[model samples]
Target: MTAEFHVFTCLSDNIGVLMRDTTTGACASIDAPEEGPILAALEETGWQLTDILVTHKHLDHVAGVAPLKERFGARVVAPAREAEFVPQADLLVNEGDRVMVGTLASDVIFTPGHTAGHIVFHFDGAKALFAGDTLFALGCGRLLEGTPADMWHSLQKLAALPDDTLVFCGHEYTLSNARFALAADPDNQALKLRAAVVEGQRADGQLTIPSRLQDEKATNPFLRADRPELARSVKLDGRDPVAVFAALREWKNSF
Candidate 1:
């Protein structure tokens, strides 16, 4: 049976999602930005929380974890490298590890950049990815605790996923990200069109998440760093893809 996902917003910009398997009653929480929304989502869906999947050790991501776990006696699955900070973590996963959400198995993909030990959960069967802060719709997270090179490689790992994958990231930053994308890639018709669409979506008080990986691959500057056109747009022609990616990240920080 297919998995059902409820993607919601919290903490001004953070995102929280709930996943439930239809065939079985297995349910999981993907990053708890806050408790109220998560609890509300659970009650609305009538899906008992069975597990908490953490992408990193960030406060916004784990703050509501304790409350939810107490309520449901859920298992908290977190990255091993940052286990000390994750409260009541029951399972510590690393790259290539398999984590089960009921009978469905999600692969652990280490995507450290936003944090030194950040990770993403990829459920190939569900055709969905819980990317947390490693990537965004039209942009990516800042290099808070990692080098540009580290983030670039991490993004490459995520980019390799199938184009049809639906990316459930951790925020509603697409409007601003689209503006920066235009500045960096003014000549991209697909990006320009996407920016307009994003503006309208935000203006109407809508969320632009669960972005397709195909769209990101075609337009996101970080993901398009290897393209010669993108390199020229950033005035970094002939540079390594990682360097171009670094320039884009720096440019975005101040954008």
Candidate 2:
């Protein structure tokens, strides 16, 4: 009884995901970015949608929720803190809660900063993380509503996950993130190699997502803010990791 996933592009750069539990044939959509693509994917795979796990209240993420639920009679699971915005949710979950899609279970991790109530789903058994707009490939979400310290703490929680974990983020921002990573950590050999790979991926009309957590830990400037080399790269030697993270984020805002 293993878990299976289908990744597809939706509404410009957004990524849509469909997860299925092989034991029970229960399927779930990570977020409803758009109904047409999601429905199309379901039709193509012949997997019935049973649940919609939402990460936050953002429109792009929730826009297709109601329509999909109506189409498939799927249960909607959303963050309790943002329940007001996600009026279609059938279940509201908080941090440390467990969400089950048939036999597949996911741990809910409250990850604010991208939005006040953002949450990511970690399927420990599958080593898969569905991070919506919170953590990108080599970058992280903008501090739209939360502080630098909040984002830093949130990132630390994710960075603590096993090295083998696979991260499926909400968008295809890896190319731009790679460029920023090179500027932020030019001396990083791993980053240089990754940037080259990302370049080729995008140039060939490919997706560079589902990135390995180990690769991110090595090349992502956001996750490496605590490292002395990253601090020196930003000329913030001896500064607190949170401060270094803040400087890197601010630099990325304009990058």
Estimate every model's Cα lDDT from 0 to 1. Answer: 0.91, 0.94
lDDT of 1 by residue, 1-255 (tens): 589898888999987888888878799999888899998998888889999999999899999989988988999999999999895899999999999898777999998889999999999999899999999998998888999889999999999999999999998899999999898888999999889999999999888988999999988988999888889988989999999999899888877
Which regions of candidate 2 fall more than 4 Å away from where they truly are?
Answer: none
lDDT, candidate 2, 2-44, per-residue tens: 8999999999999999999999999999999899999899999
lDDT of 1 at 139: 91
Single out the weakest 10-residue window by summed lDDT for candidate 1. Answer: 15-24
TM-score of each: 0.98, 0.98
TM-score of 1: 0.98
- Model 2 clash pairs are none
